[model samples]
Target chain A: MQLDATDRQLIDLYQRDLPVCDRPFLDVSRQLGITEEEVIGRLQSLQDHQVVSRVGPVFEHSRAGASLLAAVAAPEQQLDLVAARINRAPGVNHNYAREHTYNLWFVMTAPDETVLEERLGELEQQLRLPMLRLPMVEGYHIDLGFEIDWEALP
Target chain B: MSTCTSPSDNGSTLDEQDRKLVLATQAGLPLVSDPWGALGQQLGMDHEDVLSRFQRMQETGAIRRVAAVPDHYKLGYRFNGMTVWDVRDDAIAEMGQRVGELPFVSHCYRRPRHLPYWNYNLFAMVHGTSRDEVEAKAGQIRKLLGATSAGDTILYSSAILKKTGLRLRKEKATS
Candidate 1:
């Protein structure tokens, strides 16, 4: 979707701290010199267009649950089947097909490590594929929120 | 001082109320005037109570941030590359931090290399409007890694097979 100047401004300014108060749209609108209804209308439109995924608190996975980056090399023919099975699991949140030997990759999280491992083990046995579980050893940087410069895009 | 809380250590810290709060807002906050009130109504608690509980969670580092998560693909950043590098273990921490500071690079982390089969230890995700743009950004990372980077590859996601917001199911089956 083509973004107008207001949309661009809304994106540029509201990356974080979205007015944690009653009538957040009113607050935001006042700052942007627009009406509260306009603010809400614009946000609703953005949401409808998939520009803004959500407006809420993003929990740190470490605090929310135990998670790991798991991958498996699926035969091209079976890739779809394997991915569909993995996606069926409740713990698997994000699954992707990437260009690599280990093509099917996904992130799984559970309430605890033992539970996570048990689920992964069950998945491995059911899929009959060696699931490589690579948990983050060290997190250097997270909270990757930033403004996108639309003006600079070619 | 605020320190990183490991998921393993903090998993049990989430009480029933916290879990309820999380599950409630997993989809997103209401776009209405009083979202906390909306959540409070759902939980049969006061709006102030909900807000205070969230504040406590934030202080404890449970909630990362209350913000808007934009869709990169919809925002014109069509190319999302997970650039992985096999860098010298000794030099990874410093180099990883530097690479993470790049504006376009998000979610940088050091993961264990599985050896012979998998050799990448550092991962930095770069987003751009096109494959060429992402490739250029990956090139910048390569230049930054310099001699410390033994080998690297960019795994561009072909398809997002599944993507969903976090949810704490009522059933304990998965957990």
Candidate 2:
């Protein structure tokens, strides 16, 4: 999108997760020889441009929460309505529609399993869909980061 | 840069602009020779300015990563299992912290103690090319954490529903 060298460098930092610290911007500034204010300002520009999505916690579930990777199968005619209902659940982090038997897919996080059950049961009754609770059968030990550089590949 | 704290060290006051920056970097850290350069051009700032704030936000714990995301499945690691450990109440946090630091142990977290149903207070994801390989790895973790009793189930991804970095600023939905 016609990025300048400075802007490009900032994005490069973004491309590679920026270091987390008390003065994260300052840390980034030191590497690029820019002031902290400039870092803040440029980030605003990126947001204004809608080039970047979010700047929040890539929360490590291991921190302090109960989470599960789960899904729901909704009847075809009621798919959209069911999806909207499932998304409304407080603990549901992500939701999507797929061609598989399990049409609605999502991730749920809460303080505990009882909470998850309570919420899911309510959702099941409300949406009238059978919930397929597929908790992580195995703890997956690998990073699933998508390579943005693939766009640049020939 | 001087940290602008709003009387609360928890950093709950981190505003919109700050949130946007963290969200963008998390969502799309473009892979290019000059990714920041590209970002700055779009954002209307110089390279140095953008870099510094990333450091500041991270320091505040408003965001987590500014690094690479790897594809675990394609890396020849076949077996991926979520091993739920029923460790003592006090030991869960310490065990989780140490386990999370492991390069091989990718995702770790603590949930409720659901007995007979899901008694795991501490959960760690283990991956390897073969079932035996991952099992062996999981055994190693059990030994290290000194878990009382642990059970693991293999979860194969039937399909990925939606996988994208979060975008707080709300871009137009892509079809």
Candidate 3:
């Protein structure tokens, strides 16, 4: 979907630090020189087209819960089955098939370490495959929102 | 005020009310014009109270930002690569910061390496419109790492098996 100037501007402007007040859209509309309804409508449309996933608070990774990056080298034939099984676990949020021997990679999170560990253990037993558990030691950048090069995007 | 909190003390500062707020908005804020008011109504807190709690959370680093999250794939950033680097342990902190500051690098972190299988400790995600673009960006990072970098590779994601961001289980509230 091609975003017009207003839509692009609204996205770039409000990707971070949206106003914290009643009628936040009103404040944003004023800045965009459009009515509050227009802002809401455009956002709604953008969402419908899957351009904008959602407008929400991004919680700090550590502050919210415990999470780790994990990978498994599922056999090529059973890759889809393994992925479906991994996705069934509530904590397994982001899973991907990467170009490597250890193809299936995912991230899992739980309320705390104990629960996260228990879930991981159960998953390991269930998969019966050697899994690489790579927990983050430190984050150099923690999602301050990426700068979208409008020209590059379709 | 000290803003730095250790990862080991996860969720220690958040009280029951804060957890409620987190649960309420973790998925996404209501799309209504008066979202704070709508949330206030749902949680039985005044709109002003809801706003203040979120403000406090932002100040304390509990909330990174409350904003629109764009889908990279939808936005035409089709190629996404997980660029991994094996940097000298002594230079990792400095090198990771430099690599993360690059415009193309989205998420960068130092993770533990499972020796024999995984030699890379630093991971930086690069996204682009094509494989060549992503490879070029990875090349820039490779140049940046220089001598401190032992080896590196880009793991291009072939498919998204699952993409649910995160969900705080309701059962955890009772725990």
Candidate 4:
């Protein structure tokens, strides 16, 4: 779906620091000079088109829970089967197939370290594969929001 | 650009009530005119209480931001690369700070390396409109790293097997 000027402006504006209030959309509508209904309508449309994932708060990784980036070298023929098994685990938020020997990579988050470790251990035992456990030691950037170069977008 | 800070430094832990709020809104805020009011109704919180809780979380760094998360692929960022660099241990901290400041680099971190198979410790996620664009951006990073960079590789994602935000398990009843 092609985004009009208003749609682009609305998205760019609300990508960060959305007002915290009872009628946050009303506040946004006033800024955009559109009706509150239009603001809601536009957002709903964007979501329907899968352009916007959701209107929400992004939590700090460690603050929310224990998390890790892990990968496995799933055998070529069993890649889909392995990925499906990994995806079945509740804590696995993201699973991607990358172009490498360690083909499947995923991120897992649990309420705490004990649960996280237990889940990882169980998965390793079940798969009978050595998972590369790469946990972040330090984050160099604050995930404020991505600044999209709107003009470049197709 | 903001400098790097350890996640642990943001020291406030979530209380029971705060955790409840987090669980309720992790999926998203209600897409209504009065989203806070709707959330309050669901969580048994008043409008002011919900607002203040979210504000406090934002201040404490528990909440990064309340915003619309765009689908990069839909926004013309088709090429995504997990660019990994094996930088000199002594220079990683400084190098990571500079690398993360680049506009195209979405996420950057220092992660532990597993020998023999994985040796890159510095990971930066780069998104671009094309493979050439991503490679060009990675080239910029290479130039920046200079001699501090031992080696690097870009692990381009072939497919998204599954994607979702962090989800907290429903608390089990305590005896």
Question: Best candidate per lDDT, number?
Answer: 3
Clashing pairs for predicted structure model 1, backbone only: none
**Candidate 2 lDDT over residue span A64-130, tens digit each:** 2355666676788987777777677777767756555556768766655787678778887887766
* DockQ scores of the candidates: 0.64, 0.14, 0.73, 0.69
Put down candidate 1 lDDT per residue, A1-154, tens digits, no spaces: 7778998788767765676665677888999999888877787788788898887788877766689999999999999999999999869989999999899999988877888999999999999999888999988778556558686564
| CAPRI level of candidate 3 | medium
Off by over 4 Å in 2: A1-105, A109-122, A127-154, B1-3, B6-9, B31-34, B145-147, B150-158, B167-175
Worst 10 residues of 3 chain B by lDDT: B2-11
Please write out the lDDT profile of model 4 over residues A31-138, one tens digit for every residue.
999999999999989988988888888888677678899999999999999999999986898999999999999998887889899989999888889999999999
lDDT of 2 at B136: 75
Instruction: Report RMSD (Å) for each prediction in the order shown.
Output: 3.7, 9.8, 3.1, 4.5
Q: Which ten-residue region of model 1 chain B has the weakest summed lDDT?
A: B1-10
lDDT tens readout by residue for model 2, B5-109: 553664534444454455455554543334555566777665666656555555654445554233345334445565557777776667777767665676776
Alpha-carbon TM-score of each model against the true structure: 0.90, 0.56, 0.92, 0.90
Q: Mark the regions of model 3 whose C-alpha exceeds 4 Å error after superposition.
A: B1-11
Alpha-carbon runs more than 4 Å astray in model 1: A21-23, A152-154, B1-12, B172-175
| Reference-based lDDT, each prediction | 0.82, 0.56, 0.86, 0.85
Model 1 docking category? medium
C-alpha lDDT of residue A72 in model 1: 96
